[model samples]
Target chain A: MSESVNQQPVPLHEHGQRRPMKKRLWWIAISPSVWAIHFLACYITAAVWCEKIGEGNLRPLQISVGIYTAIALPVIIWVGYSSYRNFRRGDPPVPYDFDDPTDRTHFFGFTAFLLSSLSVVATLFTVLVFVLVGSCD
Target chain B: MNFVPSQSALDHAGVGAESIAGLFWVMLIGGCLIWLIVVGLAVYAIVVPGQHDQKRTRMLVIGGGAVFPTIVLTALLTYGLAMLPDLQRPAPEGSQVIEVAGVRWWWRIHYRMPDGNRVETANEIHLPVNEPVEFKLKSEDVIHAFWVPSLGGKVDMMPGRENRLKLHPTRVGVYRGVCAEYCGEAHTQMAFDVIVESREDYDEWLRQQASLAVAISDEAEAGRKIFAGSGCGACHSIRGTSADGVVGPDLTHFGSRRSIGASVLPNNADNLTRWIAETHRVKSGVEMPAFETLAEDELRALVRYLGELK
Candidate 1:
């Protein structure tokens, strides 16, 4: 099975050189736009919390809608295209070492922890601003 | 707005606000820092090649960080549960029981006093100051929320169900109450007032509400005929007459009541005219259909007759 497998390297992608390098560079530049999307996600989440606790106007549907459009979309494209680019570069495309089930579970748990932290820090900053500065009259 | 968090309500609110604000800040700060730490570990795990191989390193990251956080959450839950009883303190003797039914764009309030004499009104709720009162809440239609800031937390107003909340008024003031749910359009204007009065003032008011219907001019008799005839009796009820419509409040004492149109506006000749004519304009989402096209003379007579209910 090892002998039959195609190990020989191929071009990064069929259209690698066909498209202008500027466009590829532009896509690479556009990739960081995820941060803007994430910022919006964070801002909306904060708005939602304000509406819930501050005004009692927040609804679950509103939050879910905001997450998908403001948070999930940008993240999906960012991570997906980034991985694709690595494969296109022909540099050891797949790392089999990280495929262990335990590793995957750990990675997810680690991610959840970070997301929760973001929630905490964001809430703290919001409340501090309201308290110290008295944002609303 | 007698219900405005009285002195006791304010105290409840103050303490509640402090704890809420504290938890909010705690969640905010702690949550943010936790995110940073977890993200840092994840970034390291992903970028630092061969760092994934060391099981000890993995344990150090996951065990010390993620597992510990889970324990912290359990503790938070325990702490919250410990405070639940304080939220349900008992009402005092001779307390008022205000049954609040959340309706679209308004609130249907029924106050059943200790003597079994019941006073029902829409939108307007007046209570005595320094009294321990309980609210029996429900919704007539879709989901709604009962929320009065400067008092206590909120509870969902579910249909065909009842939820209760108790509060003690330590101050004499007016506070606003809002329907904190997204039931339909015009949700923004669905608001009410809690008018807390002094004990003596409340006793006098209750006595007035308990009296029989007031006398009206014989000329207003035409309006009474129209009220009973024009199918208004189908949706609204006048306790003294054959109008037993259950869709709306009992109008037996409408003429003597202090407010009108579910307390959206003061009960006056002109306001009553406008409400009867164009209720939807004043409150767009009001369940009652607009009667704006009614004739001028007929409107005057109808409003007068209704207002004569004492």
Candidate 2:
């Protein structure tokens, strides 16, 4: 059944299948993008608070950074989980089958997982900025 | 301003300097190591002609790229963050409070005492060794940075707002202070000398500055009259004389300063004469108008009078 499915000719006008293929690999970009967004959000909010609200009152800025970290971490973890699911689904019966598009999808999934792992670490680093650095003078 | 790190970060003048220097070294070493590892791996990948196992390659990427950076960055971030509060700690009790206002091309300093009285000085800042000094930094016109590299980090002086920085001078020596942020045309020549001396000497200097100028010679007296007639009082102020203008630097002890023209030139009769005659030639874009109308002798007398201000 798997060989027959692999042998089947892919349709030229089948836009639906191509979209899913691309969507499955979208996590590769989303993980790091989430990290960059979270970093900027935390930095900008802290700078605004430090300059405007006086450094003595840092609780509001601290809360905002905490919320940002909380949001970023979960999204990165979700990306990692999706990557893992896709990786398992795209596993070739014959390991290292580069000729097969399904097998190639597995490689992309693995790349997503690695990127998501790094993103999770980067998000934690951003959280560390709030934890370590003072919000104000 | 010169890009040279104000003084060697290795001097470890204060907590801020020490911590920053430590961080710099750590980053430098760690970065080099990381770069070498990455390059080595790339070289190995290029040179080695073999069919690599895909699963193993993925594992290697995860281990080397993600895991390595996370571990290293986590350690560095923790170490750096821990040093922040200590570097910004408030000055100790009995520490001196100096209000420094950053003008276009000079510094207006007010030494605030414990008794609520304030002593005003300009261009040069004198500090007592080993005493934690709190600088109340502000700007009259544009943003400026107060940086005495040997003491601590640079702090921005923003107009319409007050920022504070604490510096504890460990050594009794003169350090060059350059305005780290660019303000205007004369910013390059905008420099100040920070003299760190014993507490007794600093106190003595303040006391001397509080009084009027000492007795001027008959020759210097002629110069003072020329200064008065030239409408110098409209901009510059000499504490012991009738000249009291807030538009420019207070020349109360101008003669005693080591450098003039905002540390642009050595404080001497010739430099002062040239500075007064053509202010624009000495320091471009200065607020003080040139006094080219004054005769050569009159200019000399004015320079002589200012030299006796101490």
Candidate 3:
């Protein structure tokens, strides 16, 4: 029942039925946006601290915090910006699905299995953070 | 303030390991207790199987295994967090500070003796027994870890940044030190020794080392000429004479220091002669080239001269 990979549906007032405007915006607000803000704050604060105090002399705790924020910031920014752009432009992106354009279009319209797979990737990232935190003094 | 084990690293390392050992005992005993209880319950349930619904079997297992494990882990984690604050000791004050720098396959030591006098040595380190010693660790190129198992845990020696380790070895003994970090091919053979001596003997040793730079017998003096002319002086250093080169270990206290070839060979005349004559033979991955071209007599004389530096 999936369409070609390149198809992206524009935001419409009615899909199967009429929906409220506020409800539509709320539905469109993905979790990555929240992640972006969280990471941005963590990263900016740490980068400023590293710059001001010099990275060479960081104590173990500071080093752990700095490394985690530094790595998370760029990846979050890149993913959040790109996906948010595509969602707005009616050209939503799907990272892995090349053939089914229908698979690319969903905001909440994500594949249950694909979203489940994100849990594995997210878990791996969390594990890295765990190890980093463990190194803290 | 240096990175190497300026007494802090050594003491903390010991404390850290002891902490780990304590936690290990707790886990082993606690986990076994939980395991026995859970297994006992399971066996009791199986002895009278089907009293609960067969469909409930999976749920029971999940609850017993997964949920119980979560409880066990949380308890352990709580205990660990409670214990973590005491895991490592603070850096010691009123300690001897030694700066140890690691190169390709060797170590360079700069001992800042009391009275602000700096005695540069390599590979071999001497400390007054029972004194707390601190090491400021650095690496000239690749990453290296300063590890002396009996004294302390490993601390990485990173270039540009200083890492500190503190050690208070109570015994008057010679213990081996090794490069725990894998930099290259010669990493394993990269080793040294910590020589802990009586306070007065250590002082006497230092004075002899300081003077050996100038006072050599005639034959050793002649062999010293051979050392300089052979380009060995370019990598090695012998203070108070013309053998000043930054590429290798400081040889001013070569005879007095514990080991030769970084930590490779025993500090004796035969090893010194073999090391100088065919360095690669004794320590295969060592950075210094073999001086096999030297005449046998010249090599022996040079070894004897270096040995006398003590």
- Identify the candidate with maximal lDDT: 2
Model 3 lDDT per residue over A1-137, tens place? 33432234424322433221221323334334434544555556555655575554435435554565566545544444444433343343545254333323344333322232333344334333433434222
Measured on C-alpha atoms, candidate 1 has an lDDT of: 0.61
Q: What is the Å distance of residue B14 in model 2 from its true position?
A: 3.5
Per-residue C-alpha lDDT of model 1 across residues A72-110, encoded as one tens digit per residue:
444535444443443334333234235333232233333
lDDT, candidate 2, residue B268? 94
Q: Model 1 in CAPRI terms: which quality?
A: incorrect
Count residue pairs with overlapping backbones in model 1: 32
| Per-candidate local distance difference test | 0.61, 0.80, 0.63
True lDDT of residue B205, candidate 3: 70
Taking the tens digit of each residue's C-alpha lDDT, what string does model 3 give over B34-90? Answer: 889788877878797556775676677766766676667667766766654333233
Chain A TM-score, structure 2: 0.75
**In candidate 1, what are the lDDT values of residues B203-226, reduced to their tens digit?**
886676666556668747888888
lDDT measured at residue B123 in model 1 versus the true structure, 0 to 100: 69
Give the native contact fraction of candidate 1.
Answer: 0.00
Q: Name model 3 segments beyond 4 Å from true.
A: A1-137, B1-17, B20-65, B71-90, B127-132, B170-172, B196-214
Model 3 residue B51 distance off true place after TM-score fit, in angstroms:
9.1
Fraction of true contacts retained by every candidate, in order, equals: 0.00, 0.71, 0.00
